[model samples]
Target chain A: MLVRVKSRYRPVAMTAAEAMDGRVRRRERNAALLYDAAAELLATRSLDEISVEEICRRAGVGRATFFRIFETKEGLLREFNRRLTADAAARIDAAGDIDLRAALGHVRDAIIEAWGHAGPGHASMALTYAYHAPERIHDPHPELYALVRQRIERAMASGEIPGVVPASLAASLAVINLTAPVAWTLSHRADELDELSGVLLDQWYAGMISTPKPDRRRNGPRP
Target chain B: MLVRVKSRYRPVAMTAAEAMDGRVRRRERNAALLYDAAAELLATRSLDEISVEEICRRAGVGRATFFRIFETKEGLLREFNRRLTADAAARIDAAGDIDLRAALGHVRDAIIEAWGHAGPGHASMALTYAYHAPERIHDPHPELYALVRQRIERAMASGEIPGVVPASLAASLAVINLTAPVAWTLSHRADELDELSGVLLDQWYAGMISTPKPDRRRNGPRP
Candidate 1:
């Protein structure tokens, strides 16, 4: 009788813990659904026009559950920004010892792939968040800046790129150069994003380099 | 008595015409004041938060007068956009046959100065219009695109830049590359906007040129 009582209590305790874990997983999944639904709506319509009830209906969650997960639409957007930055940081970290140009290409491909994976609706919302809410993307992600800086430093050490350009400016320029094509593609509904990106990357790679000799005729005399 | 009557009638007719001309001038002046006031407000505030009453108050015009000029806030923004693109087109037209790089620098300086002249408040609103309402700026101004294409073609002809980059892509890339830094500076309130822009431009110029030889060790074998 004593053995049975001890075993029974252990199983009950384990089941309780398991049930709590399962509930957490379910809550997280529901929150993701709500965010995804909100992104879809935001891509097509203005934020002021979207109602919580509509988002709940699309997400297939109860209104109460939506409120439980996100306090407001802005809060939901904040969470999305957080996740996007985290994903970008992870991708940057995963790029092991890649040269600056190739690493830039990798980052660009990863972002383009992410947009494709998110579908057109969510991708559209992502672009707005990127441009309109740059602080959210840049502030909490010093690692991102550091990653770009490190790549530039590595390139500089190897003499692959010029040493005169400031690392910070180079980092900013790299990001700007990569993202501009993506924004254009999304806004224009153009299918040539990858090709456009290739052209940009090639130009960027050649542009940052030093020529062995300066052509005086082409450059003209120095003032 | 007949001579005196004719002289009096001539002065009365002249006075009536002068009064009509003065009224037209006043109307034009009031509309300009209202547009300027709205632009200042929009620079510092989002579109939705600003009221027409506040704009009228700023412009020292009556609400009725404001409505007489612009049917709605959107109408005001549309006018601002039209004028902004027109100003840019005029500036581009005035470049003549200047060298490509110097012309580019001149254009960049002119744009930067215009932003400064607009003041920080109006400049912010202008950036939003440039990106969000591109149709208003670009559609009516093929001259803007033509200006960029002209520069690229000129540069290619002089062998100042690489010929491999398509003129269209080069034009789009140059505009995107230039504008991204401006948008960043405005958003971050960064003090080194000009310095940052110079570095970007220098990097862009160097990157676009043809390299005599690729260092096999650095580039590795092409896949």
Candidate 2:
């Protein structure tokens, strides 16, 4: 089941295949075949090693059809990331009771799990935003960002997170922090990633729970 | 004085010109010409819009020399960021007494000021690492990371920042968090970027300054 995630500036391109609607089930079928074939190939090897021709041959689809659908091989990654984000949104949405603080851990676990299943080739492509999905500079993960922002807003309303930080900024910052560690997992620095995230999250928690201390430069004794 | 920022896995390739070393200063001179031409063109137009041919023309160098010197147009960006990182290090190294707390602000201002001077065209190229310089999976900013790590270590020693968070993690996180904001500046969200960074920085401060509170998950009230 395809979940439709909303975004403010989404480049939801109405490609010719989608425009034709029900007229070309073949196009949709071809797209699915390519997606599955790409996924299977990516499981063992990096995206760099895989080719469009190989993907077409594996899928038993014509080489001409591959171009008709995806303009380039990287299109597979965009589709892959889109599905990943959608699936993440679905799962996170279902777990309605997880607090704002636990959400980062949940997201981190999700990324780790996904990478483990797919291997580094697919993992790197999905994690990257600039090259993979350069169409929209604003929404890195539109569906998930919405859910995260909502949670941050709820936290601020309940005083769980300090209301001082803007909800949008908080949500974006949270997502960026947690997603960063995925690349480190490849380099055997997963432990460092977790430790650093702990420091970052801990400091964030520290700031929210405590009041601002008076300036050290203020010439006075502590109250 | 090129500040050679050290890294563990840096692929410092000795291309033909560098391999020849002093034998062919002409190749070196041609490289400088191409680099300067790319930099000047990048001031007004993006890395995308400008072509190697245009850069060669602007430099008054042959098109073949462009390939001989830089290999690709994006090579200019790799050199550009390398120099930018080096310059930032030199400046920060000169400001020896600025505390760890102030370093984030310094880096942010440097990025912001650099963006202002270069415009969005060059701004985007310099800020992005994956596309421009994808060779290294680690060492996003080797020089800055070293300096930031040292500062964090010093802060930990002084008890200004909590010693719980590891120094390496702290430095990596600091650099990543501050760098994330540059893309937003182009979208007219510069103010929001500063505000969000404050939220992030404030939280980091909060964590370091305060002891871990007893868990809200615990059955008993605060001790």
lDDT of 1 by residue, B1-223 (tens): 0000111101223445787877666777887778777767766676567888998999999999888777766566445434433333344456654332222223223323333344334434433443333222223223334545565677677676657555665665554444344345545545444444445555566666645332212111111
Over A124-158, each residue of candidate 1 has an lDDT whose tens digit, in order, gives 33334433433332332233344445566767776
- The TM-score obtained by model 1 is 0.37
User: What global local distance difference test value does model 1 have?
Assistant: 0.50
Candidate lDDT scores, in order, read 0.50, 0.50
User: Which sections of candidate 1 miss by over 4 Å?
Assistant: A1-29, A32-61, A68-87, A118-223, B1-29, B33-62, B68-87, B98-107, B118-223
Candidate topping TM-score: 2
Residue-level lDDT for B75 in candidate 1: 61
Error of 2 at A21 (Å): 4.9
Best by DockQ: 2
Docking quality tier of model 2: incorrect
